[model samples]
Target chain A: MKPNNPLKKEKIWRVAAVLFWLAAWQGGAMLLNDSLLLVPPARVLQRFFALVREKSFYSAVLFSLARNAGGFALGLAAGVLLAALAARARPVEYLLRPLMVAVKSIPVASFIILALVWLSGRRVSVFIVFLMVAPIVYGNLLAGIKSESVQLREMGEMYRVPWPDRVLYIELPQLKPHLMSALSLSLGLSWKSGVAAEIIGVPRGSMGYALYQAKLYLDTPSLYAWTLTVVLLSVLFERFVLWTVKRAYARLERL
Target chain B: MTRLIDICKAFDGKPVLEHVTLSLAPGVTCLMGVSGRGKTTLLRILTGLETPDSGTVEDRPGRIAVQFQEDRLVESLTVGRNLQLALGRAYDAGKAESCLASLGLPGCLQLTVSTLSGGMKRRVSLARALLYPAPLLVLDEPFQGLDADTRGAAIAAVRRGAEGRAALVVTHEAKDCELLGGRLITL
Candidate 1:
């Protein structure tokens, strides 16, 4: 038999904590005696498993995942590129400052409604998710670039290190923490805003549309199931992305 | 040879270095001074990292390598990685290992820079600068955290690496100048 590791212990605690919450939910549902208002955890799980057996559920999950992933990748790329440009040029920074501020200050619902008017329901979520993620990534990366190691940069200059090598070796390593933070925060945010946009837009074949249907039919178990799916998918996706980035960083450091 | 003539620098209306003239040739030259006397500023100017108020640098090399007053090693990287970043395509693994061995840091190439002691970090920084392919080398307080025996060995390694190259060293210790057999220039 293999010995226990801290990771296994951590997983056990996480599962226990989740089970504890589920038990409390079940107890509350039992006391209230109203499945309409609050469904038990077992009912939610049963509905979720049944959902997995349906074709529409699979289609909705795929649709929502694709849109969210696409918007996130686009925003990440644009934010990183803009941040690099802004860090190097003062005029670019000045040009972007007010736009980023306005994006940050405006409400997400406002953006969704405005985008819905200008774009189709299919594109509205993509646009909303992009708007939600870009500013955060840009801000965090700009801070990281601005606060990059001047000592290391100077060392690179002294050694005549090429600009590409300096960025790869010195700047990126320093920016890893900030990039990871931006990714984690923005990933959750993109999912929230993207799903919210879908719910409001009620696009066909989307998880959000399924949620709206559940609400309209007063299916509390399905509501809880769909919400649980969203949360679980979001968490799992975040873990996978962070793990990939960490591995990439480790490999780059070796180079 | 790299020559500095009538170099002056000030920070926030306070003079750090004033009318300093010095010349470096293919040998070790030590700049000795107390703290805050602009020894570091002079080295920075020589390396073209800082601009002097009004002066001309004669016969400056096209490329220069420097170890700043701070060790300035990237804490996130390993020792070999740091050296490789500096040396780039010119890095020779065998030479690098021998150089580290000479400074009493054998088998430390893969250890991350953050895990190293202050003395070890200092030597690593020096080794990185020394490994870079440049005709001119500038080091500021390169022996700050080293013990007496390690300092002697480090000085010997530096002297060996600096052969036939114009090297400028900054320090406050008189014995360091003697150990390096360097020509003294008091600032």
Candidate 2:
């Protein structure tokens, strides 16, 4: 009785496409009839539901969630502060240019391995997340700072709007889009690179450890399950962070 | 109470202002000059927004309100906040409300500057300068984008609000000077 939604129809078509590819995967698995090579989508979903019931699974998810989220939050703060400092000071900008370039250019895997040596196994994911995110956040915030219109600044100066007012009325509005973009981008990268670090390091009670165990035991379904959960969690975290940022912007607009 | 003695300015060693000495008094003085002349340069030098290479300016006060050539309102903020930023917290809402009322922007106080028209933004900027507590008022073509009646009203309001303070009105139109009932300073 409900009218068909055009956007929902498009989404349904996308889901159908995913199902088609999944059918191909199942057909390929059947042809091989090999448990080691692959597992059906149905089995993966079933195993995912079962895995959710396990307390260790929750702990592993919680551990990774905390580390990566903590790292992201820390990087966000550090990036904004540093970018502001750098924007104001030519010397700081010069010093950080090479460092930001290095972070941006260096392979995520290389950082994971190097960070494994520099940081504790428990802290590897957090370190990796920070390394990945700091450069991204810095780049975005710096661009925002640089792109601020000169005329507006002149206006503020002429008005003699107090320092706090200048920051709130001018700088904050200019920085919002960059801040929002940095948050969304850094979150996704942090989760991906953070888990990748955990997988290589195999830290105890971490999501990466569970993935490693699943791989070692040839439990393909559990591996897929963890992968799915990580993707879902990453998306949810990004949405939540962006929502918080939007709410903050709304409050600022009101002010 | 302001004086500029033999002001000369150059950019890239090419002279923009040549031995320009001008003294400013209270009320509007419509600045007139041909294109590429130094009318804006003279205003900028007087406001201390720019320094002249060979001038000794004296007797200036702490506060000067300016309506720049470009209406420099915060695009994200409301029309009211733009004026508030200039006027400071010492400003009362009632006065701001009435000032905006005079400018025909009373109903648009809640609307953001981004949504305002070009003429509206100019009016807001003009209103801001009028409301600011200042010893001097400098206007750079403040009537750039207003209708005839609004322009007349704007001129009246500025003259009424200036209250014998030093007001320097810059305009290409001689009639604009006549309207403000002030002396003319032509570059």
Q: Could you report the DockQ of all the candidates, in the order they appear?
A: 0.75, 0.70
Candidate 1 C-alpha lDDT tens digits along A58-132: 889999988988898888888999999999998999999999999999999999999989988887788888888
Angstrom error of the Cα, residue B142, model 2: value is 0.6
lDDT value for model 2:
0.86
RMSD of each: 2.4, 2.3
lDDT for A85 in candidate 1 is: 93
**Model 2 RMSD in angstroms:** 2.3
TM-score for chain A in each prediction: 0.93, 0.91
Tens digits of per-residue lDDT for model 2 on B13-48? 989999887777886667888876877878778877
Candidate 1 chain B weakest lDDT stretch, 10 residues = B172-181
